[model samples]
Target: MKRISLFLLVIASLFSTKTVFSQLILGPDTLCIGNELQLSTTVTNASTYYWGFCSAYLKNLPAGSSIAAGTGLAGPSSIAMAKDGNHYFVYVVNATAPRNVIRYEFGTSLSNVPLATDLGNFAGSIPVNPKGFELVNTGGNWYGFLTGGATSITSDIIRFDFGNSLSNTPTIVDLGGLVLNPQDLYVFKEANNWYALTNNGFSGNLIRLEFGNSLTNTTPNVVDLGNPGSLSDPSGMWPVFDGTDWHLFLVNRGTDRLTRLDFGTSLLNPAVDNDLGNPSGLLNQPRDISVIRDCGSYYGYITNENSNTMTLLTFNGAVTALPIASDLGNFAGFNGPRYLTRFLRDKDNVFAYTTNNADNSISRLEYNTCSNAAPPISTLQTPPPVTYATPGLYNVYFASDEGLPTMQVDCKLIRVLPHPIIEVNNDTLICQGDTILLVANGPGLFSNLWDPVYNTIAPYDTTSIFIYPKEDYRYNVHLEFTQGGGCAYDTSVFVRVSRITADAGEDRL
Candidate 1:
């Protein structure tokens, strides 16, 4: 009886060890919307490995039904998944060796085609293995970063700028004091300036760096958010510049929340405050963040590390918990998804990339069919009418909703002309028969006509007119011009004439 009990205990111990060794962990997922998602993974000691997507909101996924697969290494390491055109790129570290290998797959499924590239040697001279890597583009140049390793001699950040040659060697940019063992790196531009954010040593303190036109000149700025330590630590950090401001969001590992930092007002003196107050609560180790501009709103996604769930946050500062962590209705399984990225196919289409650390696979989420709703449109106003008698140029104005999520429309200006008026020197005045001169003046008109009984004189387009007042008689003058949408109208003025006595011939009126 004693021997049987000892055998049962031994079998239980072996089973527990196998279970622990077979577990998988993933992180730093890359997204190229509507096209593909690249996920990285690290598995414990195991002879063989398999990967697939499971319904994030479902219970069970069948075995051998995964998006992709790769052989595992001995310990913890970092990998990168990205898309070049239609093909997906998977960069992995060899478990048994220091060499890193690149594999190519189609869509989200594993491929049997023998298409792989070796990146030659590590980009940096440091002997420590890399913890996070990214493919970056700056000022029309293709560059990348291999960050965080064991060696103090290795650069914290290394840049790869492949100029003109597919096989060209990458140039390394050493960020001396800007970063330290950066676990994750994100780069974005605001107001024509390039900026980067990196997670430093699981301390929950993020380092900010700015790049000059030349890649070598990098300046470092640090923003310390209180640390939560290793158990619930910060992982992926994403930064976005919305023309006016820079928004930085990170995964809060301790409280399972998505914390937002607004740097829109003062880029130089950024005041780090929480944009969303700890909304995503009780999440199992959130990893990556992806944001999309939709209908004048911003949508955010947070990928989970242990549970099959994702947290969604709206730009209105509202957070909604989503259970679509797995493939929609597809029986593939998601074990430990660590990172997420978003892509925009067009103005109307969008997609997301999720990396499952446990499954060593990737999942693609797409929003293809959009509703045909009218985009936000508005009319601009020119200068409003005022009761001014004088004629001069006035400043016109226009206003509407400026910040909508669509193509901008051109503005048009419309002008409105006011009517003209004319006045005579006097209503009644006596003048001698000796050819008294009469004068008329007012706002200028396009055309003016003066009629004397049966004939018309001074038919000119001018502001003033002069005529001889004959014996006590009345005369009429007319002015005409186009007004309001090319319509023509005429205004008339009346003048009274008087006969003067012979003694009044020398009198002035």
Candidate 2:
């Protein structure tokens, strides 16, 4: 059972990178979480106003040019980078031993370092001990989602269907256990089904796997969203939907800090949830985390693995606009950097790659621009605090430091409005007192504003509650189990309901 991601209460490590972009600075690309935006940029010799950060690049071998040495890469844990057209693929996974699954190919530039191809052993054919990997490319095929097991993490989800060449050779079918040593897995797609979100790290908890639209051999359905707060090793990938709630951004590594889990999009009694902690004592054990939008903003890259270094989070919308430490002795790459992936090397450049279990090498980070020296921070005409707590997309530029400045840099990709998922469900925390919660799944309805019967022991309504006044009342429940411990039945399907606004509305249970 020794698998806190295979021994890492510390000593994990990072690097394997790259970097982009511009924009005028008007404001309002989109915002809905904690909404606010204001700024002006029309040029004027540009004295100083730099609120932009692609965070420079090029560590170019030098600690004696250190930590960038691995021909076959050894313990590298998690990583997934894709792009079939101009070729650029990376996939790592090796929690030690012959637990293979490595591949690296480059062309058209990611600074080209490539060298390591061995995608075999399919994580020991479910002997469970891989870590994480996800490539996916839907319908037309091309898939791969790996997350080593602790036993049936919901039908042992370790699928792979390379129908269109991800180098083919996949056929593993794991989706069994629900969570205990899980580790990582982030495949996503809601409504049309096909889900996955794993991160147990020995039960710091957080699991979900539905796989309806295929994970190859299909056979899943487990939603054990346990451990709602104060998670120390908690780890389960990422999620963001801010029109009203579906948050989930995580990374704890026994608590280096960084978290979120609103649960507002409903997963049938996914029960009362909300973590929201984000502390950054500088992060040291952070195993994996990634996001990119470069230059205009929306950046987050963490992999401290006991401080091998790599932590840059500048996302002012879903809040986080401070922590930026990428000098890894002088630009980046210290080694042991766990997992990372970021693309977009054109239209403004941005290339971040990582997977370094202490020297399995690979950390090319090149986010372009921003190196006036030391801090390089500048911003005055007031335009920096635009809030957001949950929602995505943000690319805010203000740059204009006048060293050779022109004021032609542009950026504004803000789109943040994801609360309209059928009005909202606040993550089914419908509790009352002494414990009670209901959201009977899809086409919902368990009551309107309360007291429509949700247990005090009875209201397990013997089926039949279909109202339709102002049009659209639902009762589509696919249910959640409970009976020997008290009422909470299921099996009802009627579609078209609307009236969700209680995330445990005044909880007392």
Give the alpha-carbon lDDT of every model: 0.41, 0.51
List residue ranges in candidate 2 displaced over 4 A.
1-50, 53-73, 78-94, 97-237, 247-338, 341-352, 356-359, 370-379, 382-509
Question: What C-alpha lDDT does candidate 1 achieve relative to the native structure?
Answer: 0.41
lDDT of 2 at 128: 47
lDDT of 2 at 116: 63
Question: Which parts of model 1 have CA positions greater than 4 angstroms off?
Answer: 1-66, 69-132, 150-155, 164-178, 189-193, 218-232, 275-282, 315-332, 344-349, 369-509
Candidate 1, 49-164: lDDT as tens digits = 22221101101121223344444322213445443333344444332245343333434322333244545445433225454555544443555555654334443565555553
- Tens-place lDDT digits, model 2, residues 129-191: 566677766654567776665555322446666676565566766555555667766666566
**When superposed on Cα atoms, how far off is each prediction in RMSD?**
23.3, 26.7
| TM-score of each model, in listed order | 0.47, 0.27
TM-score: which candidate is best?
1
